[model samples]
Target: MPGDVGPLAVDIDGTLTDQNRALDARTLDVLRAWPAPVVVATGKAMPYPVALCEFLGIDSAVIAENGGVVVIEQADFLSVHGNPDAAAAVLADYREAGHDSGWGTVDLINRWRETERAVSRDQPLEPLEAIAADHGLVVVDTGFAYHVKSPDVSKGQGLETIATQMTFALGDTVAIGDSRNDVSMFEAVGTSIAVGNAPESVRAAADYVTEATYADGFLEAIEWVGTTD
Candidate 1:
């Protein structure tokens, strides 16, 4: 609502980072200059996206842990979804099977997580799905890692909440991501973009797929929003 483009929801990792998960200087500058409200939507823990926004000098708007946690510029406006206990039970069953969750013994990745847990992509999806099902949890593959969460939680839900709070319709929001987990958001937003590096499924879910990859693709997506009706 701050500008003509309305609010923007963007994923981190493969969408905002390079192949090495590094943010380019150009990407940073473009984001800082984005005309409207920008939300850092990622499958990372709360601290990661919150810190990213803080450093970017934008409103500390974030939808972290997929849709597990959400906030738009103020501590009082924070909203959280899902149940960590359910995800924990799933993780326990997974560990009992002798497979590591991918973060090793001291998992800094999940240390700050409140609503759900993230599993390493190195694990087989079938086995993980089985464990998650027993605990009524769903595993969302973000192309970077597998997220163990409640089926009820998703980025789409987060977008709805943030859009309402920001006084914008879902049709006024543009989402940019690069993974299967972003599909829910794609389905809910006015315009959805997938980076060129995304898989066929992800690309198919998007309204537009940038020819470029990574941060460059993110910049392309920003332009895409401007030109889009």
Candidate 2:
């Protein structure tokens, strides 16, 4: 099963995109041409991945907000599995401490975030983690941001559900990512790839580590799974 491309669960921030978070035009072309199923999994807001799928011209299958929300395309399957209220508590305390989310007042990062809150990577993590723990929420450092979410929900769980619904075995899938937030996803798939820019811990967790960084690494991963290099 590992010999085939099979299904793909890919990350956005530092895997499909460059360090500046721009989606790689080169990777976009490759992704659309993949013969197997593709799942856009990200720590981003729900609308972001959904919109990406729309632009990619693929069906809407996504695991957004670090698995806080799962949408199975045209099947009308929408499952939200996090405590936004708890996440809000952490943010509220963060504000009380005279700290902003650091994305400016508009806070587009968390504005459309329904199931959780995303704190800018520049913000101090200790206080936020304390607040989240007080509210029974967990904080995940995705390298791009700190996500406050429920412990029960994860990208791994989301992939498992989507795999079942799509009628594919987990052993037939591949996952590519570049952050600790992707660790769960790495564990869930049969073949896991860590981009060159990924943290050492993330790379250690993956089944293979790419020589190239960012979207290039994504393309390298696809090639390893029997897709065109």
Candidate 3:
């Protein structure tokens, strides 16, 4: 029942967007009409959540840069504590490690392209996987871009933080996603749903699968919830 639920935590990438970053009208409706608060949990940067809030007409919580940062309205709750100096230090370590391991440039954005080629070639999977594993980074396969981020920062970690801040009982919230990053959300929410077009691995981790993609998936999940509890 809605009475038991406090807030809704949803992912943004595959759950809401297609090959392009288009918002689904059906899914937007669910989010707009939700009686409880809505939280956008994503691997995107701070700007992403801000843009979504404006688009969705929602003024609520957001988890960005994976789980490293969080904002509710204009207030920041959790943070990755970015400092140019500190970032430089970490980047230096990353570069040396990447170089030693036969990895490419420490430039994350550029390295991602190289990583994709490696995955595509199916040659020396260990090199790519090792870099991520060594740094406790989770490799986010976005089809267009691969993200290697600190293990502690991600959609799942963001969901945990959102749930805690909202005082929402774990068994009362619903989460939706379409990738491995979403597995964390699936594990965190009372209901874990995947879109019909989700990867098999994602489907394997979900409690339910929708018959649509993007906004359609979100709408399906909402409709399912309306009928069930």
Model 1 scores a C-alpha lDDT of: 0.86
Q: Rank the candidates by TM-score, best first.
A: 2, 1, 3
Query: Residue 41: error of model 2 in Å?
Result: 0.4
Per-candidate TM equals 0.94, 0.95, 0.74
State the lDDT of candidate 1 residue by residue for 1-229, as single tens digits: 1366767789999988999998777778877887877888889998999898888988888898989899888545999889899888888888899877888789998899999988888877888899998888888888888999989988888888888888878887789999887888999988899999999999999999999999889988877777764
**Candidate 3 per-residue lDDT over residues 40-64, each given as its tens digit:** 8766666767688888888858876
Output the better candidate (1/3) by TM-score.
Answer: 1
Worst 10-residue stretch by lDDT in candidate 2? Answer: 220-229
Choose 2 or 3, whichever is better by lDDT: 2
Q: In lDDT terms, which candidate is top?
A: 2
What overall lDDT, based on C-alpha atoms, would model 2 receive against the true structure?
Answer: 0.88
- In the range 1-229, model 2's lDDT, one tens digit per residue, is 2334678899999999999999899888877887788899999999999999899999988999998899998677888989998888889998998876888888899999889998887888999888889899999999889899999989999998888888888887889999888899999888899999999999999999999999999888877767432
Candidate 3 residue spans exceeding 4 A from truth:
1-6, 74-76, 81-128, 134-136
Pairs that collide in candidate 3 are 67-154
Question: Which of 1 and 3 is the better model by lDDT?
Answer: 1
lDDT of each: 0.86, 0.88, 0.63
